[model samples]
Target chain A: MNSNTRPVADPRPAFVENPEQADQQQALGRRIITDGIRTVFLVGCGGSLAAYGPSVYTLDNRVPQLVVQAMNSDEFNYRKPAGLGPTSIVLVGSHTGTTAETVRAIDTAKAAGAESVVSLTSDPESPLATHADLAFTDRPTKWAWDPKEIAMARITQGILDAAGLAASGFDEALAALPADIPNVFADLDPALHRIAEDLATKPVTYALGSGPMEGMARAFAMFYMQEMLWRHAAAYNAGEFLHGPFEMTESQAPYLVLCGEDATRPMTDRALGFLNRYSEHVHVIDSREFRLAGVPDGVRAEIAPIVMSAVTTRLAQHLEAVLDHDLSTRRYMFSVEY
Target chain B: MNSNTRPVADPRPAFVENPEQADQQQALGRRIITDGIRTVFLVGCGGSLAAYGPSVYTLDNRVPQLVVQAMNSDEFNYRKPAGLGPTSIVLVGSHTGTTAETVRAIDTAKAAGAESVVSLTSDPESPLATHADLAFTDRPTKWAWDPKEIAMARITQGILDAAGLAASGFDEALAALPADIPNVFADLDPALHRIAEDLATKPVTYALGSGPMEGMARAFAMFYMQEMLWRHAAAYNAGEFLHGPFEMTESQAPYLVLCGEDATRPMTDRALGFLNRYSEHVHVIDSREFRLAGVPDGVRAEIAPIVMSAVTTRLAQHLEAVLDHDLSTRRYMFSVEY
Candidate 1:
């Protein structure tokens, strides 16, 4: 069967079956500290790249001792950073583990003499996982905050914990995700269905978010809408939306605003205020609205981006159902070679 | 006269007349070294924030000793990094020097006990300049790579030189800009007029670039096309464009691809190849086409983005003329408050 013709599956989170995966992630972190790694470079493509948002945001805000950077995999390989040497660790992600640039990033890291190369993907047998010094494979998932992001977040938590910068409740939050994520879907599904219906025929959709949630916005706008549905869409940082893209507000284009319970919430709030006044087709998915039972308050904001990503994924699913479009279909991706 | 009602002048560069401005920038860098500043946070809004791209890219690639970051002013203030304390310097930019969040970022920087607060703005008397510990003022210009970006680039060079990581030809290239930029306009005008006319009636235009040139892509798509022309436009990092947004290629949308003579040129080259195969309305502005007289080959790529920015600005000017839409016209910004 042609992979491009595969039917769209319902979006859902998939977890690693091996409980020792957590220990493995911790071991990776211990290796970084033990090896005297001073920098961590996160490189990936598309939604895989977006999955690093929460972890990057957390590291940027909380872990000040180490240098952290995120880049699209191809750019990472092309503009090789001067800092990515023996004192650096490269964490690369790709859902299929066959993304050409991501697989090459492992080679790039090795070429740069990085202390270690880690990969997160669903296909354990693929090139990316086979090439990396360490690989974490989870069950395949088509949604955000699933196998890849969950493992990536766990790996980041492991790194932070190893560095003595671990925040309380982070581990607890991770443990609770299995039970908590289903509740998030149940709570969000109805609203998402309504949103999908409203947005189905819109000329163009604009997704806006700030800070960590901005990644989810990009995932929804670029990956889901443009790639999956072949719909016109674009994502903008909320603060930046005010700077220029706000001109489209009065155009009455549909909008999806992801509001995470982080410090950058005010930016989305400000944009929302203007959006509500100027456009009638505005849909907001606020992370604060959902309660993840076992996740405590301190870590909620840290993990809100992941939850919001999950919501956007479910919304994309609803749009797929309503529009009768297969998410796997593509015009040029693998069908016609460039 | 209401600033909003003012006529749109032909876009051009306005520079600072003070030779001592360069000395002041070098002195600022010297202070950073003397005060043991370890982190340099570049904060701004809209085009102001985009101006820091090349400097960020350069610092990340050439000088790995310091922690360098760029963020929207609001996000910078909201998610204040734990690292932003006594050993940090905050460089903020705003064209009018009165952007609310940029002014607030100065307070945020001061409250965090940063070593110094630097403001780059056209208005010396504005609150941002008035409150910042050090302010650099330049002549007002409504375009990319003009007063703000030039000053920011100079400041970056100063920091690099102070840290003994100075690359040869950077200063020589800076010195050549005044004479070189007008030639860029002359060189690009005919092609740009055609591009502007071709793009004027398009429902949406997409801009793509890689590495240093990506900043110019964003400035053109967001600041120029969206804000100034009130048109729908979006920018994609050329490498990332393949990840998802490339799905729009066959839609026959007009695309503006900026190619610079940099390591990441191949990323854009790959995208341009795919674009050429898939789309008919692809317009490319390659920096290698322009001979920046005094800028040696070593530093040409570093300054290529600035030149590409000038070309895009010229393109926007032609767009404004062809569309019969005043670039200064705005529906909501400063008109009806949110």
Candidate 2:
């Protein structure tokens, strides 16, 4: 099922053809947004919730009528919000939908006066999905280990759409995703393979970005270095590199900066320029190089980075497997009960 | 002046008596809030900003009218927020009020049409305070190395007051802060010192929290472990521990949880309970144990954590210093150019 030599064409096949998953995701989105809930709290772990950082930024900035918080599911039930009434919505994200923390979160939300609950997952029968008022599944690819990013993006867009906000641009971006992602895989495969090979030899690697991309960089660092490669990796903001992390940048340890769109570009350039002065170890992945497969008109410019980051990350994962590193050993995993 | 053995009644004498510094911080706060500003953006570094997290949470939940972002000042200016107009107010924080990033942030906010800027600092003529429309200084006690917590709490309350909301509760909370904080220091000081000693010997340490306290956990882990101890300290949601970081928790490198007052307290307790089952190395800080020195009536229960967390952190810093750490080291300082 896993091949190191063959180039993976697309990693989302399991989700694309699975009708059950699609229905679940849509249902979850609808229940949370259209159910007359005053507040929506989304919970997940690692990439599961980190994937929603862009959406969190968007909702906080654009949606004044709705209050949204993206938190780890384990924390949801334990540190429950004070004012969550019966009209509140709680959404949990778990790729397996069986994560104990996520399940507990759903239960806690239900107990707290949350009138509606939704789950975004890859498994319809998972404990979390089974307990939710509605469930959205983005079929988990058997060959791929994690599908939380795609599931989250789809569900987050659905939530926005259900809230009466047009998500046509998001839909268009996602539509283009399947086709556009292959190109990134093609362009990044060799570089990723090279990095993976080198990662085996190096002690640490730094993943850096600015703005919303900081979360993406962190996800990559956590998923690839900590989980897949079982190596030590650090995530830093592009502007913060000079503050202290820059000292660690020598001929030995290198850094990768995810220079995605607009405001982050300049910071990326500046960091790259500064690092170039010290050593030739800094690498940048510019967002402009990739075309937005297809985005709707009037889509906020800020939203593009959300979709693009997911694509960049998926490609980075392939690099991890190609290097023949362990893909399941996580350095830090939060227990759901806590 | 530097007596390791002496039990000083007040460690923050420099701050209390420095009228010049007080004038600077007050001026900064006033300038940013009242300078015909349509929106206010707050920026700070790790400790300086962590001190302000609760206030940011309170302001966001209560005011919602003013835009507040707990961002690194460097990132704020370089990666400006979309839709920022000429009447925006930019507020920057620094212990010295002269951090390079804060200086650049103030300049950037001004360039982007900030009607007025404010600085919270310990130094009256520090670059950040000097450049502001007004600056507010907390009494320069050594214990109050980073007074931004009080400064932010007051400023946020002032904004609420100006916006026609009653701020007496917030003001009363601030008044009670001085009294309640000492007990936290007395209670946690010995434990933190011992932990610092243990951490100083270890290769890494991890700080964990959930909900609004998540930001505080990150700030503490980064500053204490990364900046002070120079050890690899990671911060994560209590829920995320099981997803990945838990894999690394052996009998050796353990995790620390900063349990703040929030909905996730039960979860944190459960997580701590579970972690104890696995390893005896886990440490927990229940923030509510310390009495708030001057809490006023009508103050929302949610706002208590913000002030309490601030007090807890000041105590943390004293321990960090005893561990032979200072953030002012050359590697930690970055030049600000705007």
Which run of 10 residues does model 1 chain A get worst, by summed lDDT? Answer: A1-10
- Candidate 1 residue A227 C-alpha distance from true site, Å: 1.1
lDDT of 1 by residue, A130-226 (tens): 8988888874443435676677777777777877887899878878877887888888888988898888868788999998988889888889998
State in Å the error of residue A306, model 2. 6.0
Encode model 2's per-residue lDDT on B1-338: one tens digit a residue: 12252231233321243445434444444555566554567787656666667666665555534555567766676656643557666778887776777888877877777676777777777888788877775534545534666566556655666556545566555555566556566776777655555555565566777666676677766664566445565677666755655555566666677776655566567668767877767766677665555665456354556544554355445545655455344442453331
Tell me the lDDT of model 2 at B102: 80
Give residue A193's lDDT in candidate 2 (0 to 100): 58
State every prediction's TM-score relative to the real structure.
0.94, 0.76
Please tell me what DockQ candidate 1 reaches: 0.73
In terms of docking quality, model 2 is: acceptable
Q: Which pairs of residues collide in model 1? A: none
Q: What value does the lDDT take at residue B47 in candidate 1?
A: 87
| Per-model tally of clashing residue pairs | 0, 51
Error of 2 at B297 (Å): 13
